[model samples]
Target chain A: MKHTLSVLVENKPGVLARVAGLFRRRGFNIHSLAVAPTENPNLSRMTIVVDLEGKPLEQVEKQLHKLVNVLKIQDFLPHEAVERELALIKVHSTKETRAEIIQICDIFRAKIVDVSQDSLAIEVTGTEDKIDAIVSLLKPYRIIDLARTGKVAVSRGRK
Target chain B: MKLTGAEAVVKSLELLGVTDIFGIPGGATLPLTDALSRTEKIKYYLMRHEQCAAHAADAYARATGKVGVCTATSGPGATNLVTGIANAYMDSIPIVAITGQVATSVIGTDAFQEADITGITLPIVKHSYLITDANEIPYLFAEAFHIASTGRPGPVVIDLPRDVQNQVINFKFPEKVNLPGYKPTIRGHTRQIKLALEELMKSEKPVMFIGGGVVLSNAHQEVKKLAENFRIPVAWTLMGKGAFPDNHELNMGMIGMHGTRTTNTAIMNCDLLFAVGVRFDDRATGNLKRFAPHAKIVHIDIDPAEIGKNVKVDVPIVGDAAIVLRELNTMIENNNLKKTNHLAWVEQVFEWKKKWPLKTPDSTDLTPQFLISKISKAANDKDLIITTGVGQHQMWSAQFIELNGPRRFITSGGLGTMGFGLPAAIGAQVGKPNALVIDIDGDGSFQMVLQDLGTIARYNLPVKVVIINNRYLGMVRQWQELFFGKRYYAVDLEKGSPDFVKLSEAYGIKASVVSSVSELDEKIDEMINHRGPYVLDARVKEEENVFPMVPAGASLDEIIGGD
Candidate 1:
């Protein structure tokens, strides 16, 4: 099972390396990791999505807790949280297929961020499934470049 | 202040409060070395090998629980540090490894003496960085120290390219690091704590399996208090050696293979095994199925995966040991689950202890046991810290020395690494300068990084190194004796060992040689009272073995002792 872990750590030097080092040393396969400043000025939040199941996730969580700079670790399951991902895809476009591409974007609720007659830059935001669906739809339009912000999530309950 | 990489590294030292460092200078690190030559605030001890440098830094960190520092150049220099870095990661010691990389442009091109150090070190260090820009050096170095010294402390590396070392830049040490992806939870969930307590209260024959994490958390008092409150006999892993005083009534001593007979017995028969701050390493738990087979394990660790990695945990508290322990203590106090007596189990453990006493050989020559005891007696309980390399010496140190305080006995517990002593002794000495620091090392283990003698002498650090010169890799020989039917292949150490007195003199220190048991105390005292680095090269019987050793693949009952 894939695990998405939200870690809040002190915005201090070398912490990223430490966390990454720990995962690598323990042989935890990380699918994607994104770190950004949190609401707290002194803290940073990292969302690490790892391809680990059962006990390894527990061990990683426990180990992360040991870092002094690390303030919190929240392991989010698929159903317990609201997950979101953002992706930008630049597609080869022409007068002939431009309308068709725009129609596909409308169907997926994706926004066209940029258009240069020959190319269309589309931005999509949703759960992983939604993003994957949009990417699949854009494949026929000949996508030129693709970039994703990995996965970021928060719990569903009022906090 | 505008500074180059060398100056940033030097200034970063002051910022990190590092008064001394152990390293060697090469073409890649020359710029930093030149800057160090002019600095008076921090001292540098030139080492012979990068491995020795890393080990010394690691040792220093372990001894004092501070971030030990080491520096090396690019390529093989950085790779040589891999072993020591891995050792620190395994042992959970705080250390910072700084290496010089080739200039940024040539990094991927494989310029002379270049290596992908950060990439290579990625898995070993708690964190690592490749400072492509000189401006980032100060902040990165500061962050490295902060990360290395805090949390579940471990090694961190910063690879400074030579170009960065020469580039003068607008320098500003960031007040704080802005990494967003690394948060660690310090506190445990209240519900989980309550559940853990419930399990503890309901269970019979509960055993507390402690690891080095307790010491790292500085929760020895709390651990001892909790153990006493629950009347739980504590069985430590190698990493957990000094967490509880070995002489304490509840201490069954180090458990697992090579652990005490009583401890293994307790582990086997226990109903509830409460493991705190311990990773279930294979050495600690042989044949996972057979390990604590009957125990309903409550594993409290900061790492979540460890909870069910090897040994399954019924109640897993995924948080800091200190935080969880404090919570557990509070609940125990509030609920009043203190047992009046575990007299029967205590008596049973005592009976086992008496039945299988750690016996010594009848050889007239001095033994590692007597030597360890002599060293332990020579130093005060609170002031002196002991560090050891792996092998027979490490096991003997655990078995013989009564560690009354936490973080006082530093050893490569999880890694079982050789060449851990001298540098660790330096680290311990650096942690507490006023205290007497000693490395109770074996000759074979000591030779792994004997170059640390240079580091010790150069810094003028007061560390007494007592080498148990047995002229053989005693542990390997013992294994050969036990499992390989005494067909010793390559365990001999008769070739490389030089005269201790001569080696010490080369390092500008005095060394003494003792052959008999009668001269043990006098030699120990002489080393203890020496003003600076000293060596006691005590040549014991060549084949002296660490007894009461549980043969591999066998139960604790199959202990091998007696000649």
Candidate 2:
């Protein structure tokens, strides 16, 4: 099962290595990981999506709790959280298909961030599915370059 | 005095006389490593893997009596060290593993890379901790070392957070550790000792069974004095191989699965079995129902949990072996146990020793058994230490090697860990450099921690490794042949073994090979006499098995002995 874990860390050197090392040593696979600064300056939150079954995840969690640098770990379910992925897609828009690309972007609520003579770059931010849907729609226009920020997620509301 | 987690770690190294540490850097542990940067006295070893780091530390601990130290970052890194820690715990080696943790404020909130390493390691450790206060660091460090090195020593882990490491406080290493929760009883009850002596004096057929704790307690002298005073025959468990010198007139050799026929017979017939510092393991006592059927056991150990957990005892005393033995010595004189002499039993034991003397087979070629004898001769008592990996070589060492002192013969008896020899040899060598340390190991066992040769080379430790290159897991095969109708499973290792001499050469250790029995004496002499680490690969018979074997599931009487 692929599960997303949001971990708050001390934002120090070797912390990533330690986390990666633990997973590697245990033979657990991480599908995707993105670490970024949070609201707290001293703490950095990392979102890790791991493909592991029951016992190994529990074992990894237990061992992670042993590390001195890791402050907390939270497992976020897909259904409960508002997840988003930002992707920038550039399409081959030679004078002819630029208006059609703009029209499709408007339908998806995506904004045209940059325009060159031969290409149109669109920035889309939504649930991973929403971003993928827009990227698929613009695929027929001849996609030039594509980049994505892996999944970022948060729970539904404050208690 | 108060200290930060960083300085506390430094102070701990100073206390343990540790010149080096093995670990990697991480968030929670950064402050400690940063502090280490300023220290000239201690050097840090960075390992590619955290598990390897723990193994290196374990090896160091087994080689040296000092607590072997290793560190890792939070969560995964800390988790990687579990196997090595468990290995140390099983073998009862003294090690201190330090790991970084997530800060206290967000500890349970699933912080980045944070793990509950202390909780995970609690079951495997003698003691473990999570220091929230900066002032607690010094005391905890000292206590961890104390707990690790003293009594029945094992590994302890101290989890440190980034906040604890960063906190500033006046640091002074305490002269004494004052942990109220862990007070190991140093002295045994005088009354209990008196009762044990009375039991010894009254019994006509009393046998003394010793364990590894005798060596751990450094009570060989006391054990010897009591044995001589009572004139009782001594038999040992696998761990207690060297507790009593095997060459002694009263020694019946090791008593268990591969024990001598006479020892097995004596154990079954003895009226009182004085088991000291030895856990009654299953291998030692095949079927508990029939184990020591004729004898009333007197079990003495430092760990209370181990007392009733194994074989039940009529009399149990929980205290330090050395302390208990000392008290027992005094009580014996008062109770007149000294006045009683068992010349008849001594004569019987001597007769048995003569009948079942461990003699080398008449082989012109250099044999593994003969090679072990040569190693033992080179070791020559005088505080010499010997370590062995599990297999034919281990049993050969147990049978042929004479243990003149306690703790001098070190091996992983309970776990039967193959890779134990080299690392343990390192620990023993580091612990006593003046003492000649020899690892009488098998090829199968030596390969497990072959990478540790790097540690030996880096440190320039003079550890003599005698590799019995039989090219097989001799013990497993022996059992398979005897019990499983000759079905050879994964026991054979004829294919993958490196040219051992060349491998040793690659590791920068002086290497030698004795393919023939004719070359055994001279080659072993050269290897042992060399001051640096030397590996001597002695090619012995492949089919040789450790004998006088007690067929499993059979009674003690059903032993297979050489005619």
Candidate 3:
């Protein structure tokens, strides 16, 4: 099973390395990670998606808590949080296929951010599954290049 | 109130109640050393190497229960403290290591004596700081000390640039540290404690698996009470030696590989594992899947990561060992749960203990085990503090040296660093000036840091240094003989090892050699009675193996050389 943990750590130097080093040392498998400064300037929020493969997620969170810079960890269950990933896919587009690419982006509520003589850059922001659907739809057009901002999430609550 | 960063550091240390420090002076550390010298309250022990200094500081912290401090110059000096720092980190000792960096202007410009000490030590330290401004010194030192000494304690590094040390600032020490990310849980959850207590009450064959946390939390009394009042057998990890009375009736001795067969057997058959202050380290667990196979583990540790990281835990109480154990003991006492007795189980454990004890032949053929037994018996002080270097001698000491209280037996349990004993004894002696500190060392282990004997002689620490000279890397030799079919690769220490007696004498310390069992007692007395530091080289039979050996990764039940 996969676990998505929201870890808030002090915005000090080497904190990311400290957290990452712990994971590496403890043999925890991480699927994807995203980090950015939070609303509080002194703290950074890291969204870590790890597949523990039956290794208790509690153990990983507990280990992360041991890092001095790590302040708090809130694990988000799939239903309780809104998750998104931003991906820019450059697809091989011709004069005939440009309209089809634009149509696919419109249907998915994604925008075409860039266009080239031989390729079209499509920027998509949605849940991982939605992005994966869009990317697969454009697979026949041949993806020339792709950039993905793995995952970022927030809890869906008033608090 | 304005003072240089160096002066501020010294003042802060004085206020922190740091009475002694161990280190060598270098260019980056010159100002700090000068400031330290001006302080009459703190005595500094000049060490031969920065590694020795760190080891000394670590052992001092273990003995004194205060945060130990060590200093070194940047680059090589800072690097030298890595093994010692790792050792302390592994064992959860509280130590503050201060390293002098190049001036901030030349920090990354490849300046001489410059190293990224903070970056290098990041993975090993609890927290680290690189002084950017002189103003950060007082608060940073306070925070460093706080982080070092509090909750699951470990080493913290403070990298101070020389310019910061030279900068003048108004220095007023802060009374409190405000680290939003650094709060440690002191008390275990109430419901978890109740569940643990229930498990204790319901168990018919409970075994108390103790670890370094007991010594770290000073919870030996609580452990002893729980074991005695409840009639439960106890088995301790390497770090847990001296955390309980070694000769007690319920004592199953050390656990895991090379543990007594009795302890291994008890763990094999136990129904409930009341593990307190233990990390479930692989060395103690043997094969984790089969460890306490029939038991429901109730682990109590301040670090929650330690509880379920290695094995499946039934209940985990994350809090200080002393706090949690005291609560459990009080709760059990108040609830009248002491009436639950496992007499048959206790008798079964005792039967195993008697039948599967570590064997020592009664021959006079100069064995390490005999020497350790004779020394422990001959020592007069009830408060004897013994430290040992890594290898066969360490295991022999762990087996033969019977200590009555916590903080009495200090060894390199976690990292198993070989050169730890001498400097550790030095640290222990300095920390408890009146106590008899002895370093049970091996030839291979002693030769690693014998230069630090000069530190002992200079301070007249009166540490008894007993070198068990087996003329081989005995543990490795044993391994080669057993696992590798006696190929005898590089296990010989004969050609390169020093004449330990002459080596000690050259340091202006008393020295002697005892090669036979007849001279063991007299030589031990002479070494102990000496006013200053003394070294005894006990030439023992080579190629002896530690037992009862459970081969690495094997189940606890598959032990060899028992009885």
Candidate 4:
């Protein structure tokens, strides 16, 4: 099973390396990780998706909490949280195929961020499934390049 | 008061009650060294190597239960401290390591003697700091000591750049730490304690499995009270050697890969295992599937990550060992729970212990076990602090030595570093100046860090070094003899080895060599009574191996040489 953890840490140099080093040394499998500044200037929040097949969830949480910089951690269940991913996909385009690519983007609620003579760059932001679906739809147009900001999640509530 | 960062560092250390620091001076740390030399509050001991300084600091912390301090210059010097820092991390010893870094402008340029020490030590330390400004020194030093000495104590590193050290700033020590993320859970939850007590009352064959946390928390008395109050047997891990009296009737000695036959048997037969302050490492739990198969485990530790880490627990309590045990003892007393007589179980364990006593070979040549036994007998009357290098001699010392108080037996249990004994002995001796410190070392392991003999001789510390001179790396050779069909690949240490006695003499210390069993006791007594540092090289039987062996992957019950 995959576990999505939202971790709050002090905004300091090398904090990311410490967290990443711990996961590496302890042999924890990290599926995806995204870090960004939080509302507080002195703190940052990290969204990490980890594969917890053989390892215990409590142990991982405890280990993360052991790092002095880590302030808080929240393990989100799929139903109780709102999750999202963003991807920018560049597709090869011809004058004949450009109209079709724009139509697919329109259907998926995506936007054409950049356009060149031979290629069109499309940006999509949604749940992982929606991003995957739109990427698959554009695969027929010859995907020249693709980039993804891995999943970021938050619990859906006022607890 | 306005002061340079170097002066602030010295001031912070003095304010934190640090009386001594072990380190070596070099190019990068010259500024700090100059400031330290001018300060009269902290005495500095110059070490031959950064690693030895770190090990010495580690042992000093282990002996004193205070955060030990060590320092080094950048790059190579900082890199050399890795092993000792990792050793402290593995054993959970509290230490503060300060390393000098290059100037901020030249940090990324690969300047002379510059290294990203914080990045290199990220995985090993509890926390690390790379100072960006001189003002952060006071706060960082306070935080470093706080983090290093609290909640599952471990090493913390502070990397100070040369320019930062030279910069001046207003110096005022923080009245309190502002870390909101690092509060430790010191008291056990009442509901968990009640549930644990209910399980304990219901258990017929119960064993209290203790580890290093008991020693770390100074909860030896609490552990003894809980065990004796319930008529339960106590089994300890190697790190928990001195947590309970070895001569106590209920003490089951050590439990794990090299654990006693009776201790392993008792654990395997128990109905409930109450483990405190133990991580249940692989060496402690041989073949985890078969370990304590019949027991419902109740584990209590300060670190929540250790709860279900290696083995699953039925009842898990997260709290400091001393506090939790005290709470449990209070509940036990308040409930007026009648002590259940476990005569049958106690008798069964005693029978096993008597039947499978640890044996010594009946030979004219001095065996490691026999020599250790003689040392134990000779040192029986004094307050002894025993340290060891990792290998056959270490196990022999653990098995034969009688430890009655906490922090008496110090060794690298988790890391099992080869060259730990000599420097650790020095540190322990320095920490407890009144006690008799002895390093029971192996020939191979001793040769790894014998350069510290100079440190001992210079300090005139009365630390006795007993080298069990077996011609081969005896532990690895034993494994080869048993599992690898005696191929004996690179296990020999006979050739190109310095004469330890001569080496000690050259270092201006008293030295002796004992090869016969008849002279073992007399020589050990002489070494113990020596006024200053002394080395005794006792050449034991070359092929002797530690026995009642548990093959690497075998279950504890499948032990080989009991009879």
For every model shown, what is its TM-score relative to the native structure? 0.80, 0.73, 0.96, 0.98
Tens digit of lDDT per residue, candidate 2, span A1-159? 888887778775546767777777667888778888889877788888888965446557755654445777778878777777788998999778889999999999999999999999999999777987998899998999999888777777871
lDDT of 4 by residue, B3-92 (tens): 999999999999999998999988889999999999888889888888999999999999999899999999999999999999999999
- Which candidate has the top score in DockQ? 4
Over B5-79, each residue of candidate 3 has an lDDT whose tens digit, in order, gives 999999999999999999988999899999998999999899998999999999999998999999998889999
Instruction: Give the per-residue lDDT of model 4 (tens digit) for A69-157.
Output: 89999999899899999999999999999999999999988999999999999999998889989989999999999999999988898
Can you tell me the CAPRI class of model 2?
incorrect
Per-residue lDDT of B310-357 in model 1, one digit per residue for the tens? 767788887888888998898888876667445577678777777876
- Show model 1 residue runs off by greater than 4 Å: A1-159, B37-39, B334-337, B380-382, B553-558, B561-563
Off by over 4 Å in 4: none
Looking at model 1, give its docking quality level. incorrect
Model 4, chain B only, scores a TM-score of 0.99
Cα error of candidate 2 at position B17, Å: 5.1
Candidate 4 local Cα displacement, residue B211, angstroms: 0.6
Q: What is the lDDT of candidate 1?
A: 0.82
Best by TM-score: 4
Instruction: List the DockQ of the predictions in order.
Output: 0.20, 0.02, 0.66, 0.84
Higher-scoring candidate on lDDT, 2 or 3: 3
Q: What is candidate 3's local distance difference test score?
A: 0.89
